[model samples]
Target: MADYVIKTNQLSKIYSKNKVVNSVNMHVERGKIYGLLGKNGAGKTTTMCMLLNLTYPSSGEIFLFGKNPKKHSDEIYSKIGSIIETPGFYENLTAYENLKIISKIRGDFDPYTINSVLKMVNLDQHGSKQFKDFSLGMKQRLGIAAAIMHSPELLILDEPINGLDPFGIKEIRDLLKRLSREFGITILISSHILSEIENIADVIGFMDDGVLIEEISKEDLHDRLNKFVEFEVSDIDLALNIFKVLELKENEDFTVSGSTIYLYTHLSLRDKFNALFVNAGIDVGKVNLCEENLEEFFTRFVSNN
Candidate 1:
């Protein structure tokens, strides 16, 4: 069996009469980046909270590092770090001062440790600046630095780049990659931004309306993204008939939805297919050879269920 840093079975949560999070089975391997993605209110945060024991699960089990967290909360927390929503600090405190307080609160740290985490996050030079004077991205870095002060084995972050500019997003992305590559820290991060997740995640799990829909590795996702030809016709049934006469296999070669037919094979024959449709009195509203990109693929995947 693979060594999993975090695992859940039938994990669920209910608020009042509404089920906010349904039975969810999640697997996050050790020393890998796992991106949990969904729209706001998809219960991504709820699930993470349950894993951290901030919120109790209504059903199911959670295992962190192959042991029940409930049985070892002290041992579990010592090795896990997290930032949910915005990380807070005294506005007037300098970056070093804020982290110093965090270190003091934790009751364990050498003076050298503060600078190490800050340097790892690229905030080492900004020590003199107060938290209020720092940029959004800088604040995030400090949050991360605080989370990593003890050098935990696992880091859970929720929307770390939500409002960051492109440059800031890139900064955080690079930092996370470095942590995963250099330190071998397993990370479970949640975000609604599809492009950022695609750029950094080794594996992705998508949730919709509190249900975890699917989880796939980045390689499998790329393999499944096929370039195809899209045909918008006046009639889907007639288009299917024309496809049959042309000896095109159903599903294997083409799929129909409403007035649209997508051909996954023989993409080079788009012109010939258009001619055949026109010859059969089928109104070809538009025929364009199209390729599915990541955004479109994600939308189609999550919305289908």
Candidate 2:
């Protein structure tokens, strides 16, 4: 019975003959970071656009803070901030100057707010630096500062770390974590960087070919990433029978593949499995711990889907 900050039901967008965004139901819980993961042309951006009311949905509904976005456009959007793709800024203006313009448009202009937000994003010292003179990371940081300057409760970032170096990426990642945990801000971030998303996101939603294929929590995803002990035996059928006798339920505690059985239980049970097989007169050829990381899991899921 947790409250969702953003929810979409059968949200879709079509462009002529192409269904850019198929029916997608997304859920973002309050004060948690939700990662939207997909490869290029997976409709991640389109989905964000619909939520932000930037692009109208072809069919379906969107709710922000429990109210329909179209019905309460200004009131609902005022509580949200977003950066889709590359953020545009007046190249000739200084960082502070650019944010001043945004603050004015937002009608929440405050000098203290500008300074605090710039400092928060590590752009305080660069306030006087022109947008054209800033580095890629600096520009991105400024974009984030502008997004959060009004202190919105929700943030939607599409590949915010797209061009950042390792250090910059880590900085942004830490900032995002702090925003969610400390400030209680809900975030929906889209990225092709599976590792970063895996490290930071509480929940992950995967999109494939414009379809939302799966949505799972980080802990559940780790469990689903195929971590187990694989046992190769001389007699496959006999091993399965032995497993059954041991009360190791198939497709639950173990799975079969040709001449091998993979135990889904922890590796701590390795000794027990070996002893059981050996006592049953089954020649256990090999036993090895196997696991798949997020990147490998994502690739496999996409290919299979």
Candidate 3:
């Protein structure tokens, strides 16, 4: 099989002349969690829908397991499990009964597998509880149980932790990590919870206004938002003159805000910079190292794009 578990090329979805997903190319590598992040109406769900073949793309192609989805949809989808939006279950039925129905529909009914998945998601103890009486977290866990009971090679979850408490969220996070690490399942998860995604995802795809603006690995993204030195000088005008004299490229090398200058490079030459200012008859107040976290970086990226 190809290296990518999921791949899309120039995928587009349009309705009544409005482009919901526009020329989006995405890649989800084997055995890695790819976080699809965006605000509402940013086309995250639509993109997932197209990938799952729930919604036909207006143009372009989708590949699952290295084959075109249109040509191998049945074989491909059978190997993938997904929970998009709220999953439906018989409210009056117990958790076990609900999964039993799903097992029949899946046509690979295995009682032992069902029980194993329920235990995996921490729903085994609550299997006798009626779905109607289950808490939101319990219901979500059941949904996960149903999705994984068949042991699919790939999983696509849209906001799986929506109604979860902090503890529930951590439980699900650890479960996903375990699934990926132990079973070698590739996951494509979409969430507005950037921090959770930052913590769990191996790669991140940022979307905005129906466009895939950037797809970057978590490590590379962190490096791009690395720490920089911020200098608070006494004279703004004289600082600019000094920078010009030193052939420093404005904005490229540093940014100015009132009396503060943010330096993006030459971090190791901090003493040299200070000496230059001292020799140039400029007064430097404070110099501090600063860094932007993922959320701040995402905001800046969205605003810029």
Specify the highest-lDDT model's number.
1
Off by over 4 Å in 2: 228-290
The TM-score values for the models, in the order shown, are: 0.84, 0.81, 0.83
Model 2 lDDT per residue over 115-204, tens place:
998888888887567899988888888888888998999999999999899988988898899888888999999999999999999999
* Tens-digit lDDT string for candidate 3 (1-305): 53999888999999899999999999999999999998888999999988888888999888889999778878998899889999899989988889889999878788888888888888888756889998887777788788788889999999998778998888889989989999899999998888899999999999988899999998899888857788888878988887788788987998888899988878888778888887878888998888978888999899988
**Model 2 lDDT, residue 58, Cα:** 95
The CA lDDT of each predicted structure is 0.91, 0.90, 0.88
How much is 162 displaced in model 2, in angstroms?
Answer: 0.9
User: Mind giving the per-residue lDDT tens digits that candidate 1 earns over 109-200?
Assistant: 56799888888999989877889999999999999999989999999999999999999999999999999999999999999999889999
Error of 2 at 30 (Å): 0.9
Pull out the clashing pairs in model 1: none
lDDT-based ranking: 1, 2, 3
